[model samples]
Target: MESFLVLAVLTSAARAQEVEWRHDYTFARREALDKNRPLIIDFTTENCFWCNKLETTTFRDSAVLSLLNDKFIPLKVSAQLNPQLTEALRIQSFPTLVLAAPDGKILSTLEGYLEAPKLAGHLQRTLTAVTNPDWMVRDVEEANKAITAGDQARAMGLLKSVLEDNQERPIQVQARHLLKDLEKQAADRLAQARQLEDKGQNAQALQALTKLLKTFPGTQAATEGGQLLTTLALKPEVKQEQRTRRAQELLTQARADYQNQQFLCCMDHCEVLAANYGDLPEGAEAAKLVEEIKSNPEWMRKACESLSERLALLYLCLAENLLKKGQPHEAALYLERVIQAFPSTPQAEVAQVRLSQIQGQPTQQTDFKKAAEKEEGPAVP
Candidate 1:
């Protein structure tokens, strides 16, 4: 009966586990590339902590799970069983997401524990950069020429637009940082002008600052443009009003929240902005947020939680996601976090029982895992 009980528990555990939808190598190669999605290869080992955390927490997240399902042919390679494959992929980390082409060409790679939004952003950016036909990677020499020849405006314009549009793309992050530094030089020139003006050298100050404003309109340097124009009694062509500035400020705030893992607040602000815009770019962004929220309300809530709200519900969803995965040990860890963090909530009570079962206590069995694993691939659902 003890052996039978063990068998029953194992069966139940298997049933509860939500196997990532996956495809065989052949099918993955054909279908994934055809759809312009990368073949997502996850290199993992048994009993690895972050690996299991990803499987239980991140992968099980409905938003992340849906993106994986919709955007890639996911492959889970057990590094132990496939040493050759691991070595070939150069697996130095336990949970590395390899973005590969259908022909076994690795486009790029991301490693470590990524929260849902960031993971999704990285995935989308890598895929966009890799799969697109017209990506231009200019050499540093060419880029320098563009800058030195007074084409800095053109180069900066292109790079800045790309960075803004692809904020989650790793390449964009690097590009943006580089551009920001360059912009700072222009801003410094403007500041020097202000110092000259303070010293009563008005003519020299105006000359020095005017050079920067003319070169980079709508930039940090350009903030002084309006003031300088007013001083000269000249009306410059470009004008960003108070309302426009306020809108831009709000967008910046929303982007910051999105970056800081406050996705729900990001979504909320997006929605409000969208309503005002009447189906403009912000509206489309808000639509995307609505879709993401619908896909993973539980995980998003946890991710977007504020300091004031109780975390019991978020913990419950985490526990549930873990229960869906086969990692009881890791599931129990999060369940404890939930219990300890939000002990008063009813969700915590349910989490306590789930945690007990995860810690080897007996629980009712189910066939959901087998059914789930039987799905075609990560994109199966």
Candidate 2:
């Protein structure tokens, strides 16, 4: 029984260390590039208890370890020993996990310790994104083809789908550009109604606006026309059209708020539209927009978070490069800036650790400030 128990312990230890982590980031990068796979950088420190917990617990989980071993070029980076590499990677905290494309563009980052299940999910998503690379070019080409075929509706639908699904900033900008062109085309189609309204042809303008709304339902021009109908309805002679116009105006405003990234404001407008104009065409669009916003509440937040991480990484990289050139003071200044500007972020934690190391202080002695106070407890074992 004693021999069996010792054998079991040895076997478990071997299983726990199953993930073949590359010690060198450069080698891992090279392997990832060659294989066209994502580079998974696991940033850790000698004194980080959480990092040990991650290795012993989450990383020991068979599913999590198997996925990392199979799908990713995993690199184990020591934050203490590899200061320059750590800074370059912008490892803000111990146990900061980064998933990057073969070209070293960071796809996603998870700070702090995650349980096996959550980490597995993140790994799966990253693997899917890396392996099944979805390019905006395909959607762009499809939209262009639809436009050439004179299928404006089909083209608009494709563009909208791009906006909804594509997270790449460049692709989003391109989609927006295409949408602007489509919006202009739509505006031209409704020019007659606007002209009639400008000429004080109230009945004719109303007729034209109604026709535009019917012909181009669920469009930007239709939305604008709906709002204008509300404005016209407010006139003493057009009071009879007031009821539906108010709802249309609310729905239009809700959509505008959503596009502007004012998510909370959009929700408020959507609620009003739903309560008052649920039966109207604009209301239907509003309902869809509300559902989309609710379903993907983190879309804008994730974008902002990704941008912040990139900016922090930029500063850290610059600082590291400067330090390598024998400019400790300048490096310290950049680290200080990171701590000051992005307190509570992973970058801030890294800065704190690095700064402490430079000052001959304890690595665990971090003067980190929280972005928001929360119930504090050990995040890992």
Candidate 3:
């Protein structure tokens, strides 16, 4: 009687328990990469009968469930809904399954209906084959994945390693074949870098040469690129451009600092800009800002007030941290620093009170009368 009857669907909860399917390929891929799991991408269509049957029968099988749960990230990509992705993978037939690595390297593919046991066997065999290989095949697969991810350098490294391994494996031949393509790519990049250098675009050329060296380290193109990098980097035009760019950056920072009431730091940046890059337009602008800061009475008062307040706050913060660590004397040193440095700011008053508490006595402010009488005592030179 059992032989005469076809197997029917089992428990209602069987589908949920046996298979975990992800609809979005990107999310599934991220999860797979995070977990270091391979992927089983099930390509399907709404009208596909075999695809539905697999959900009911093949997915319900205990062996299939165990293999999927333990070893793979299962994703169901609908050909109808995801036409672009389907076209990318070229999934023409309904119910096509692709087993891929975590990095999106397709390891194997199967089409049409597969009985549960046969499907499980196929997965098991794939696992075994990937595990027991001479590593040349796996390295090639990884190289392919790197290339897909826009990491040509990594791909080249893997291919180079395989070739240098000196193994008699058949996959070594494939690696050699792939490396020639990589060599050509390296040469093309080297050519591009040279062209940029010839056009006097030193910065762009420098970047290209650097990338070339990194991408094709052992290639002849990389060797030439390295030599070219040295010659281009030493060009006075390149050096001048770099210096001018740095001067502009410093000038911008100085302006921001001045605007933010960080006057002392602004002075430091201003001095560097005026001294080193004084010939450049940015340097000249920086020099003008410096003169304005020193000559403007209102600006001087604001700079002095803000500098004192900021320094006092910093000292207070340090003192508080030391106090938390149960170092009262250490805390007192920073508190004293606030009194000596800024003696008039609000944080300085706070520091004085804290210092008095630590010393168990009243404290007097330090006298800077003699120092102030001298010519320019550490006040924004």
* Superior candidate under lDDT, 1 versus 2: 2
Q: List the candidate 3 regions with Cα displacement exceeding 4 Å.
A: 1-142, 168-171, 177-179, 214-218, 252-266, 293-381
Q: How high is the CA lDDT of each candidate model?
A: 0.66, 0.79, 0.82
lDDT of 3 by residue, 247-305 (tens): 88898899998888677778889989888987889888887888878998887888888
Against the correct fold, how does model 2 do in TM-score? 0.38
Global CA lDDT of candidate 2, please?
A: 0.79
The candidates, ranked best first by lDDT, are 3, 2, 1
Instruction: Give a tens-digit lDDT track for model 2, residues 1-381.
Output: 999999999998886568889998778888988887788889998878999999889988889888888788889988887999888767788889998876687989999999999999998877655553265668877888987887767777777877775554445556788878877877876787889878877767887888767655568898999999888867976653565667767877887877888776777788787787777777788788778876884955654565677788999998899989999899999999988888778898998898887888887633443233333643454
In Å, residue 318's CA in model 3 sits off its true spot by 10
Candidate 1 Cα lDDT to native: 0.66
Candidate 1, which segments miss by more than 4 Å at Cα? 1-125, 129-135, 138-143, 167-171, 232-381
TM-score of 3: 0.43
Cα-based lDDT at residue 151, candidate 2: 75
Predicted candidate 1 versus true structure: per-residue lDDT over 1-381, tens digit per residue: 999999999997764445455635557678775775667888888888998888878777667776677667788888888788889878988888787754566777888877878788877766675442234345333445667887766667666655655533434545666688678877887878778767866556656766776777668777775587456433231222323444556677777876776876776677777777534555566566656665886746665455324466666677678768876777788777876675444555677678666667764223223433565333345
**Local lDDT at 174 for model 1:** 51
TM-score of 1: 0.31
Quote each prediction's TM-score: 0.31, 0.38, 0.43
What residue pairs clash in candidate 3, if any at all?
A: none
| The candidate that achieves the highest TM-score relative to the unseen native structure | 3
